[model samples]
Target: MSQNHTWLEIRELAEALYCSVKSVYIYRDKNLFKAGTHYYSVGEGKLRGKHIYNLELCRKALLERTAKDSRSNETYDNKEINKLMTRKLDNKNLSYRK
Candidate 1:
Protein backbone atom coordinates (compact mmCIF):
# COMPACT_ATOMS: atom_id res chain seq x y z
CA MET A 1 0.00 0.00 0.00
CA SER A 2 3.00 2.24 -0.03
CA GLN A 3 3.20 5.02 -2.58
CA ASN A 4 6.47 3.61 -3.85
CA HIS A 5 4.87 0.32 -4.86
CA THR A 6 3.31 -0.18 -8.24
CA TRP A 7 -0.48 -0.41 -8.47
CA LEU A 8 -1.78 -2.45 -11.39
CA GLU A 9 -5.13 -2.94 -13.11
CA ILE A 10 -6.87 -6.26 -12.72
CA ARG A 11 -5.89 -7.53 -16.14
CA GLU A 12 -2.29 -6.48 -15.71
CA LEU A 13 -2.19 -8.06 -12.29
CA ALA A 14 -3.63 -11.30 -13.62
CA GLU A 15 -1.01 -11.34 -16.36
CA ALA A 16 1.76 -10.55 -13.94
CA LEU A 17 0.58 -13.26 -11.58
CA TYR A 18 0.07 -15.78 -14.39
CA CYS A 19 -3.61 -16.16 -13.68
CA SER A 20 -6.91 -15.32 -15.36
CA VAL A 21 -8.67 -12.01 -14.86
CA LYS A 22 -11.65 -13.83 -13.40
CA SER A 23 -9.37 -15.29 -10.75
CA VAL A 24 -8.29 -11.82 -9.73
CA TYR A 25 -11.88 -10.76 -9.33
CA ILE A 26 -12.60 -13.93 -7.40
CA TYR A 27 -9.84 -13.05 -4.96
CA ARG A 28 -11.43 -9.68 -4.34
CA ASP A 29 -14.96 -11.09 -4.10
CA LYS A 30 -13.81 -13.82 -1.73
CA ASN A 31 -12.05 -11.26 0.50
CA LEU A 32 -8.71 -12.93 -0.05
CA PHE A 33 -7.25 -9.48 -0.49
CA LYS A 34 -8.25 -6.75 1.86
CA ALA A 35 -9.73 -3.59 0.40
CA GLY A 36 -7.77 -0.35 0.73
CA THR A 37 -4.64 -2.38 1.31
CA HIS A 38 -4.28 -4.81 -1.54
CA TYR A 39 -6.75 -3.11 -3.88
CA TYR A 40 -9.04 -0.12 -4.27
CA SER A 41 -11.51 1.28 -6.80
CA VAL A 42 -11.08 4.47 -8.71
CA GLY A 43 -13.27 6.55 -11.04
CA GLU A 44 -16.64 8.22 -10.60
CA GLY A 45 -19.25 5.51 -10.52
CA LYS A 46 -20.72 2.98 -8.13
CA LEU A 47 -20.56 -0.06 -10.40
CA ARG A 48 -18.46 1.15 -13.31
CA GLY A 49 -15.27 1.91 -11.42
CA LYS A 50 -12.14 -0.15 -11.96
CA HIS A 51 -10.15 -1.68 -9.16
CA ILE A 52 -6.39 -1.30 -8.95
CA TYR A 53 -4.24 -3.57 -6.83
CA ASN A 54 -0.99 -3.28 -4.96
CA LEU A 55 0.92 -6.07 -6.64
CA GLU A 56 3.28 -6.74 -3.73
CA LEU A 57 0.51 -7.06 -1.16
CA CYS A 58 -1.53 -9.33 -3.38
CA ARG A 59 1.48 -11.55 -3.97
CA LYS A 60 2.19 -11.72 -0.24
CA ALA A 61 -1.39 -12.70 0.54
CA LEU A 62 -1.38 -15.38 -2.13
CA LEU A 63 1.90 -16.80 -0.87
CA GLU A 64 0.61 -16.91 2.69
CA ARG A 65 -2.56 -18.66 1.63
CA THR A 66 -0.60 -21.23 -0.35
CA ALA A 67 1.71 -21.87 2.60
CA LYS A 68 -1.25 -22.43 4.93
CA ASP A 69 -2.85 -24.89 2.53
CA SER A 70 0.41 -26.83 2.12
CA ARG A 71 0.88 -27.05 5.87
CA SER A 72 -2.59 -28.53 6.37
CA ASN A 73 -1.94 -31.03 3.60
CA GLU A 74 1.33 -32.06 5.24
CA THR A 75 -0.46 -32.64 8.53
CA TYR A 76 -3.06 -34.84 6.85
CA ASP A 77 -0.37 -36.81 5.02
CA ASN A 78 1.61 -37.36 8.21
CA LYS A 79 -1.46 -38.67 10.02
CA GLU A 80 -2.19 -41.08 7.19
CA ILE A 81 1.41 -42.29 7.12
CA ASN A 82 1.38 -42.85 10.86
CA LYS A 83 -1.83 -44.87 10.63
CA LEU A 84 -0.36 -47.05 7.85
CA MET A 85 2.83 -47.61 9.84
CA THR A 86 0.88 -48.60 12.91
CA ARG A 87 -1.20 -51.04 10.90
CA LYS A 88 1.93 -52.60 9.42
CA LEU A 89 3.51 -52.97 12.84
CA ASP A 90 0.33 -54.64 14.18
CA ASN A 91 0.40 -57.08 11.27
CA LYS A 92 4.07 -57.87 11.91
CA ASN A 93 3.38 -58.53 15.61
CA LEU A 94 0.54 -60.92 14.66
CA SER A 95 2.92 -62.82 12.33
CA TYR A 96 5.51 -63.12 15.11
CA ARG A 97 2.89 -64.73 17.45
CA LYS A 98 1.86 -67.26 14.79
Candidate 2:
Protein backbone atom coordinates (compact mmCIF):
# COMPACT_ATOMS: atom_id res chain seq x y z
CA MET A 1 0.00 0.00 0.00
CA SER A 2 1.08 3.59 -0.51
CA GLN A 3 2.16 5.79 2.37
CA ASN A 4 -0.73 7.83 3.74
CA HIS A 5 -0.56 11.58 3.34
CA THR A 6 -0.46 13.31 6.71
CA TRP A 7 -1.60 16.64 5.32
CA LEU A 8 -4.79 15.30 3.79
CA GLU A 9 -7.59 16.36 6.11
CA ILE A 10 -11.34 16.60 6.45
CA ARG A 11 -11.25 20.04 4.82
CA GLU A 12 -10.04 18.38 1.65
CA LEU A 13 -12.97 16.00 1.84
CA ALA A 14 -15.31 18.94 2.39
CA GLU A 15 -13.92 20.70 -0.65
CA ALA A 16 -14.10 17.53 -2.72
CA LEU A 17 -17.71 17.11 -1.69
CA TYR A 18 -18.46 20.79 -2.39
CA CYS A 19 -19.96 20.97 1.07
CA SER A 20 -19.33 22.85 4.27
CA VAL A 21 -17.53 21.29 7.24
CA LYS A 22 -20.78 21.39 9.17
CA SER A 23 -22.58 19.66 6.33
CA VAL A 24 -19.97 16.95 6.26
CA TYR A 25 -20.67 16.28 9.90
CA ILE A 26 -24.38 16.38 9.21
CA TYR A 27 -23.92 13.86 6.40
CA ARG A 28 -21.90 11.78 8.79
CA ASP A 29 -24.72 11.96 11.28
CA LYS A 30 -27.19 10.90 8.58
CA ASN A 31 -24.87 8.06 7.54
CA LEU A 32 -24.60 9.56 4.07
CA PHE A 33 -20.98 8.53 3.86
CA LYS A 34 -19.92 5.03 4.72
CA ALA A 35 -16.88 4.87 7.00
CA GLY A 36 -14.62 2.51 5.11
CA THR A 37 -16.13 3.20 1.70
CA HIS A 38 -15.45 6.94 1.54
CA TYR A 39 -13.39 7.57 4.67
CA TYR A 40 -10.55 5.93 6.56
CA SER A 41 -9.24 6.96 9.91
CA VAL A 42 -5.60 6.61 10.63
CA GLY A 43 -6.34 6.44 14.33
CA GLU A 44 -9.85 5.34 15.06
CA GLY A 45 -11.51 7.12 18.03
CA LYS A 46 -8.44 8.86 19.26
CA LEU A 47 -7.90 12.24 20.81
CA ARG A 48 -6.00 13.46 17.79
CA GLY A 49 -8.40 12.65 14.99
CA LYS A 50 -6.82 11.70 11.69
CA HIS A 51 -8.72 10.56 8.61
CA ILE A 52 -7.49 9.80 5.13
CA TYR A 53 -10.09 9.70 2.39
CA ASN A 54 -10.10 9.01 -1.33
CA LEU A 55 -10.98 12.45 -2.68
CA GLU A 56 -12.12 11.11 -6.03
CA LEU A 57 -14.42 8.63 -4.35
CA CYS A 58 -15.75 11.31 -2.03
CA ARG A 59 -16.53 13.53 -5.01
CA LYS A 60 -18.31 10.69 -6.75
CA ALA A 61 -20.39 9.99 -3.64
CA LEU A 62 -21.29 13.64 -3.27
CA LEU A 63 -22.34 13.91 -6.89
CA GLU A 64 -24.45 10.77 -6.61
CA ARG A 65 -26.09 12.11 -3.46
CA THR A 66 -26.86 15.42 -5.15
CA ALA A 67 -28.32 13.59 -8.13
CA LYS A 68 -30.57 11.60 -5.81
CA ASP A 69 -31.66 14.81 -4.11
CA SER A 70 -32.47 16.46 -7.42
CA ARG A 71 -34.60 13.51 -8.46
CA SER A 72 -36.37 13.26 -5.12
CA ASN A 73 -40.07 13.99 -4.64
CA GLU A 74 -39.45 17.40 -3.22
CA THR A 75 -40.56 20.89 -4.16
CA TYR A 76 -38.31 23.29 -6.04
CA ASP A 77 -38.46 26.99 -6.65
CA ASN A 78 -39.37 28.43 -10.05
CA LYS A 79 -35.74 29.09 -10.93
CA GLU A 80 -34.60 25.58 -10.10
CA ILE A 81 -37.67 23.98 -11.67
CA ASN A 82 -37.19 25.97 -14.86
CA LYS A 83 -33.53 25.07 -14.98
CA LEU A 84 -34.26 21.37 -14.55
CA MET A 85 -36.96 21.54 -17.21
CA THR A 86 -34.57 23.29 -19.57
CA ARG A 87 -31.91 20.70 -18.98
CA LYS A 88 -34.36 17.87 -19.57
CA LEU A 89 -35.49 19.46 -22.80
CA ASP A 90 -31.96 20.06 -23.99
CA ASN A 91 -30.88 16.50 -23.18
CA LYS A 92 -31.48 14.64 -26.45
CA ASN A 93 -32.15 11.26 -24.90
CA LEU A 94 -34.70 12.61 -22.44
CA SER A 95 -36.31 14.82 -25.06
CA TYR A 96 -36.79 11.85 -27.39
CA ARG A 97 -38.00 9.51 -24.64
CA LYS A 98 -41.58 10.65 -25.13
Local distance difference test, each candidate: 0.87, 0.70
lDDT of 2 at 14: 78
- Model 1, residue 97: C-alpha shift (Å): 36
lDDT at residue 50 of model 1 (Cα atoms) = 82
For model 1, residues 2-94, the per-residue Cα lDDT tens digits are 457879999899999999999998998899988899998898957758889999899999999999998788345787888877774555455
lDDT of 2 by residue, 1-98 (tens): 88543334788777766778888778666877667776766866687567676676666667888799888867879999889877744454554434
For candidate 2, the TM-score is 0.55
Candidate 2 residues lying further than 4 Å off, grouped into runs, are: 1-7, 44-48, 73-98
Scored by lDDT, model 2 comes in at 0.70
Best by lDDT: 1
* lDDT at position 6, candidate 2: 32
